[model samples]
Target: MQAILQSSDTELDIVRALRENCERPFEDAHAMPPAVYTSEAFLALERRDVFRTEWLCVGRASALANCGDYLSAQIDDQPVFVLRDASGALRAFSNVCLHRMSVLLEGRGNVRRIVCPYHAWNYTLDGSLAAAPLMDRQPGFCKEQYKLPAVRCETWQGWIYVTLNEHAPAVESHLSELSKLIEPYGMGDYVETFHEEHVWDTNWKILAENFMESYHLPMLHRATVGPHSRLEEMECPPGSPAFNYHWITKEASLPIGNAHPTNTRLEGHWRRTTALLAIYPTHLVTLTPGYFWYLILQPQGVGRVHIRFGGGLAPEFVDDPQAAGYMATLKTLLDEVNAEDRRGVEAVFRGVHAPLAKPGHLSPLERPNYDFARYLAGRLGAT
Candidate 1:
């Protein structure tokens, strides 16, 4: 682990600035300008300055557990292919074929060679161009020069992340504080159970802000999550590093009494707690007692976003029928909650475009939201 920088006076100054301005109380519910969520210029700036520069989670390491396994994905519209080489080490490369810019792979599968259907070009799992149908007759064609371009890839806590910018600092550097915050959860020991993906009509920020606070539980998710969880039990403590926020929410125990609503359980089999971690610009991880769920938000456009939910269980619980069943139940509950939020977020998205719409202030409970907005503003060069 790299040492936390404490020697440079400048480092302390940066920390001080964050401690001060970043936590300032949000004044009005309208402090965030509506333009930030609906403007094309702002979205373009984020695509370049935020999405392209950060280490974004691409998939779970377990996705490529076997030597020949591979998965093709897009991060912020940039094509990428991840594979486990013959040596068993994982690598990521731009999926675009060098010869004619064709995508090398379309979906997930195991393959000995990535053969481009467009031109019969083939490359090994390690990204070396092994064969080109007519390269021998083509002038200026060199095997060494046709290898797929590589991207910066790293694995931490059993998750794989890739960065588009070659010059960006190591992933660990950017995730330093976040790593420490999540280390206690034993995330590396978790094995995936199921994966879910969906597209939302609202801006990604709206979804993020919704997760940062539980104040809406009493209203939005009363049947799904509200009765089980309490606002007082969801604590968002201070001292988050720049670009991230951390919180702990006591899991709602099954409700009791005939007075409790129908269709909602009054008693669950076990009590669970959730440690929530939000990494700015688009990653959300919920560390539960039995499993963890990670949400990766991909911005498709100013008003569209793709959310991928990956759920995992501890290695010991992977084969436990009860644990696996519970995880499935949890996934269903989360899906219901997300569905409710989607409706409201979409409404907000449309309302924000109205002529009467304006920036909103932050609630004391929403300090994290304010912190995130500040971080976004800084990264978008709006600060």
Candidate 2:
């Protein structure tokens, strides 16, 4: 095993400086200290205070619609798997086996029982110990006491969320107000059509901050989204406890297949707008008239993040005869935008690590960046 990184007073000083900067007014606020981005010590602090304790969005619950469907992932280094049990309920369990601590599952699959590759000890879909061959001779062994451990799991608006914190609030209670803001989009009725995972070579915060604001659209995405975006038309409301959203309104330039059959209830601006929101800690999403896309971020270390990227169209679009053909165009567009973002943010990561790097003033357009910084500061101070 690799040796654990230890924090020194110098690192704590960096954390203190970042907290101070986060408390500054938006006009006076600067970015977080460079150390906060490049230091493993600081990442450790965030893992303990933020990632481990906060409710994290994993994926859409609809993805695991069948009884035996399951998705496996690492939540802050804790091997975990979420499955739909025989009763058709979503469940999450430590992917680690009880016998010799072997990981019980990998990626996504449909399994009747989870069997450990190292030892044949198996667990049922509901996380109960099912079988342990050749263990009858053990003096005090008891299968009942060896069932796989469960972690807290919840679903809200068809999205799956899991938290390692035992005392965390219910996902719905935290997101109820945000639901009101998104109800107009009929987000719940949208079916996921594309899902992919990629590991980015940049700090998680860099990408998180990048996705939360559109200030870069005019420059970073010049070849694609730039021409369509007008920074002056953006409306970033004040940050709230659950999430922060900003609107970007622009008329459709080119029709891919069909106009998004948006709800008539949505008015003028809503008809041509996209709301980009960051649900604090990690879940970042964008809701548009015809479709939605989301990014579920998992920090692998100070320099890497595992991203769960997914997008889907409204029920109307899904029912369209050309749905498949339209989705092909949509996926291509998303991939191009993602590539543009990847290049931009990775460049920022390199700059952040330079010896002369320092926090710079933030633009008003980067309100989400400010909100994200405050959220990180709050997490650092909690507990």
Superposed Cα RMSD, model 1? 8.7
Per-candidate clashes, comma-separated: 15, 0
How far does residue 93 in candidate 1 sit from its true spot (Å)?
0.2
CA lDDT, candidate 2, residue 153: 95
For model 1, residues 82-192, the per-residue Cα lDDT tens digits are: 999999999999999888888889767898889998998999988889999978897888888877889889987788888887786777777777777666556776777
How close to the true structure is residue 295 of candidate 2, measured as C-alpha lDDT? 94
Candidate 2 to truth, TM: 0.94
* Positional deviation of residue 340's Cα in model 1 after best superposition, in angstroms: 1.3
lDDT of 1 at 358: 59
In candidate 2, position 379 carries an lDDT of 76
Give each model a TM-score: 0.84, 0.94
lDDT tens per residue, model 2, 42-73:
88888989888989888888789898899988
> Which whole-number lDDT from 0 to 100 does residue 305 have in model 1?
86
Worst 10 residues of 2 by lDDT: 253-262
RMSD versus native structure for model 2: 2.6
